[model samples]
Target chain A: MPVNKPFLHGQFAKRGIKAAKGITGIAVLFIAWQIGASVSGVSSYFFPAPVDVYNAFRDMMHKGILEVYLLDSLYRYVVGVFLGSLVGIGVALALGLNKAIAAVFAPLVGFFYAIVESAWLPVFVIWFGYGITTILTLLIFVVAFPILYNVLAGIQTLPIVYVNAARSLGATRWQILREVILPGVLPSIVTGFRIGAGFAFRGLIIAEAIAATSGIGFLIFDGAANKQTDRTIVGMIIMGLLWLIIELAYLRPFERATIQKWGLVTTAEQREVQ
Target chain B: MIVNKELPKISVDNASIAYTNQDFAEPHLAVKDVTLEVSANEFLVVVGPSGCGKSSLLAAIAGFLTPQGGSIKLNGKQIEGPGADRGVVFQDYALLPWKTVLDNVGLGLKFRGMSKAERDKIAREHLALCGLADAEAKYPHQLSGGMRQRAAVARTLANQPEVMLMDEPFAAVDAQTRMTLQEELVRIWQQTEVTVFFVTHSVEEAIFLGDRVMVLSSGPGEIKAMVDIDIERKDRDLSSLNSNPRFQALRDEITRLVRQDAA
Candidate 1:
């Protein structure tokens, strides 16, 4: 046991270091691919070399094409998520607060949630025509369901004592929602938002590619049509990079901070102490 | 029988509680035909074995559960729903996890429509009184078991309820912490003049804390015996009272009553 104690601690340290290296190793692989492509002298026709894509990226930036498309994509993403989240949360809260509302809407939300967001693209395009309205609405509809459903469940599942305590202290229904229910459901809502954002991003890109032009999606599709693989590669790279930035630099950090601050993630020790 | 003629802060008259769920063969009768009068500012502790309906009586007083028969009147106003006039400290701390200690304490004040500053001031006073001033910014999870219960006490106390109904509030804490909390509670009750109707399973806790201890019989629970502690309120600290022969006698008597009721 004495020998095994040090061995186990050492094993843990080694595993921690390996996990860190593995993450950086993935970035290293991407760098290696870029170098290999540039050095191999592969003509820009086939898998367009990394330098070719970089040049294409630079040209688009210089022409202000990149900025315009990026801004448009961002706008759609933000607006769609915001509007979708509002409706989803509102409906979820309504359902969570009243059983009658839940009985009426839960099945409807469940059925729609099972249907993929892309399935609506064709109908939306037919109804609204190939425009921002169709894309944004589709994205919102996709994102809204998950957020509402998860939030509703989370709010409903709160320990009965929490509400009873509040009511005993003279908290009105509104106060209970604002003070207790909202905070209780927030982490799950964020989880739903993360899931929703992934879908919205996918939906936005698909919508852009299928119809009117002006996004990273359009950039890739148009580049492929024109047989400019360099442009296509650059578009793909930018899409990955931007989504990574949003997810890691923005969304992940926000979620982590929120969970740290207000999360009810409890351990056995904390429960015992409390 | 010269019942103390002081105005009853709470009057329970032939109250019986039965759960109205559909699946049961018979409605679960938690308490049956129980009547007691809690005097103004009196520390009345009800003790019984598990399932003896001590907590049910407290719940009825708190208006969390409606009695199927008879009534509970606070100064003769029938309690139809929960009100701020009667604060409750549950066995489980029940502090809102998302709320800071200060916010949790001030929750009732917020409902009363007090200004943030006013609520903060009152919350701070109660927090300080509960010896939790340093923990005002902490969440319930960060606090110790004793601290959380103290915070609960502070939260209830901050509401300034005329009658405080505590359902085994110290049961969740350890023995040492429990003893400390009992002393603090007694001190608070003395200072505030708030009537406390406490329910406990422990006979020693009942005898140590209560001005009058009521030993309740099991299921369809009734008051089997009542003993009034004549110890001077100021001298009734946990240590001094634990060693007091009369405290021991009352504890033994209540223990015997509860055990006999259990049999």
Candidate 2:
């Protein structure tokens, strides 16, 4: 007699199991933490339980403090990343196409890329003063270099045969740039955007902590300084959750739609064993 | 025989091609003092050993590389750069990985500012001709080697060039697929009036494809010999060529000429 397998034995089952595993891991951590907080003799202010953090989140939400701060951070992040990406891609294209310009600017760009964005925060604050301008400048600075470098590398490493083929097919210089060069470097552009966005996220938090009066970073720093440790934990948890949401909802889907669809890069599921 | 009274479709006068790079102390001369003429609608195949300048000569004509010495002209006019008049089918199918086969085929027309519907219609015709009708929505990476080369050929043909420059186009395909592609190529050439300038290392392929075969010597290549194959176009098939006495004779002569230079 043949063995009968269960109905849930394929892709859907596998995905369901993976999700369950993730939720179970988080549940285990929360349980352990709650148990430790209850048994320890330390004050709740220094080491708040998960329930205290949840209550703090509810209190902030009721007061509309969380909403305002979240929106402020989101606005800065979106605008800074948008402007930085546009500038980075534009400058890379201009410099990449002109050998003379690239020769002059490449080393200069490399110098700036090596210096961390945190080091520039003080200088930016002096130049722009502690507000949106200072924080935006830091965010843009943190975001542009990686994108510029990756895009330039993409342009340099593009196969010459594609250009030759396009030329022979009667593509004009402008058409070649639009049709061939742009699409050819799209994978690299996506990669650079991912790195730049991640950097901008971290930079936003740091800039907010030091320079801005309203944002998640400010909430975290202020809560800790005021001895509202539960509020600080709430801010930290929000930051982590926000990053996960961005990765799932935006970055991963964008990757799947472009490079993965084009078969330029393989997904983890599709990766072959060597 | 087709009369050659009119000016040749393409004329190369003492062309020399050289590559100057920092890695090399001196410029590497690829093709040296080469002169050749290809009449309109003629299928001319160039064959040689590795390191021979056959491909460089084709590149010079395609206007990818400028000849350091002489001039290559089309219809008695000087060739300056890559133009719509001359199309190339590369050995490695250079189709855009991001675009579908239909989009790739219609790219030239799109560059010319043709409307999408009009270009797609024309692209579909060429795709059908190349037996890639089913693969219109597929990417280049999704196709087999032979199928990709067929798409490359379709893309070039859709552009409607006067001359087609093929640089070892079938070199990467399997033997079975190569033979099929060769036969299909001959059929495609007969249906069109475009001149074919093909470069390859295969002697039998040269004999089977070309009206005239030009042999090039190794290193800084120059034409060693030019032989005319008097066989009829309809009779030239890979399966039947082995039994033909004339085909055998021409193959032996050309193989000996190429082997002599190889030694």
Best by DockQ: 2
Q: What interface RMSD do all candidates show, one decimal each?
A: 1.4, 0.8
The alpha-carbon interface RMSD of model 1 comes to: 1.4
- Candidate 2's C-alpha runs over 4 A off are A1-16, A268-274, B1-5, B21-23
Candidate 1, lDDT over the whole model: 0.85
Best by TM-score: 2
Local accuracy of candidate 1 as per-residue lDDT tens digits, A1-274: 3866988798679768866986798779778878887778776777676667778999999999999988988898889889999988898888888899889877987788888877888988999999899988988898898898789779868887888888888989898888778888887788788888877878888889876689888888889999888888887877777777877578756754565455465432254389
CAPRI-style docking class of model 1 based on DockQ: medium
Every model: Cα RMSD to truth: 6.1, 3.9
Residue range A35-114, candidate 2, lDDT tens digits: 99999957989899988989999999999999999999989999999888888898899899999998898789888888
Q: What is the lDDT of residue B228 in candidate 1?
A: 90
TM-score of chain A of each: 0.83, 0.90
For B1-263, candidate 1 gives per-residue lDDT tens digits of 55455668899999998764576678888888988998899899998889888888888888889999899999877889788899999899899877899999999999889999999999999999999999998888888999999999999999999999999998878999998898888888888979999999887888778889888889878878888977777666776777888777877777788899685
Residue A168 CA displacement from its true place in model 1, Å: 2.0
